[model samples]
Target: MKTLTALFTAAALALGANAAFAKDVQPDEVVKLVNAKTIKSLDELKAAAVAKHPGSTVTDSELEDEYGRYIYKVELRDTQNVEWDVALDAKTGEVLKDERDN
Candidate 1:
């Protein structure tokens, strides 16, 4: 137990400011943006990506605030086992970039 605690302490120290917050987050930023109707929901963004490549499985996803613009980034694995990287405008649900990942 002590070893585990020490490891967690070391990891948290290494992360510095990136470590977990001291205060509890009230509302998720993404949820707040979607609720305010300023940006689309994650479901909408995921649907848009899947629409481009039917039968693909979303392997990973993330929402990023880039230059004040919200971007939904998705990684997909298609039926053919090809990996894809897809980026969308979170507000407009527009496909910003979609290409096979090497």
Candidate 2:
């Protein structure tokens, strides 16, 4: 009985953690936010990233809410094959973090 209770508690904790981490922004919601000026367009955000890392190719991107603030995370690869991770403030199109992905 004790083992079963421990298993259930562990499962509950795992599920709760998964739920907290998997809160993804849906496509339509993103569109609505852009329309309402709550966030910058993806194209503009990408442009800002490219401007900072000239000649780099965008590898991956995601829009997420971190610490209750919307942010756009972009990954890039440069001519020298260096990987970069860039985070931008989705609302104001401000670059928050730009660092190598080593």
Pick the lDDT winner.
2
Tell how far residue 57 is off in model 1, in angstroms.
Answer: 0.5
Report the error of model 2 at residue 87, Å.
0.1
Task: Write the residue-wise lDDT of candidate 1 on 3-52 in tens digits.
Answer: 99999999889777543332222338777888999888889899999999
TM per model? Answer: 0.73, 0.76
List the candidate 2 regions with Cα displacement exceeding 4 Å: 1-22
Clashes of 1: 0
lDDT of 2 by residue, 24-51 (tens): 5788989998999999999999989988
Candidate 2 contains a number of clashing pairs equal to 0
Error of 2 at 84 (Å): 0.1
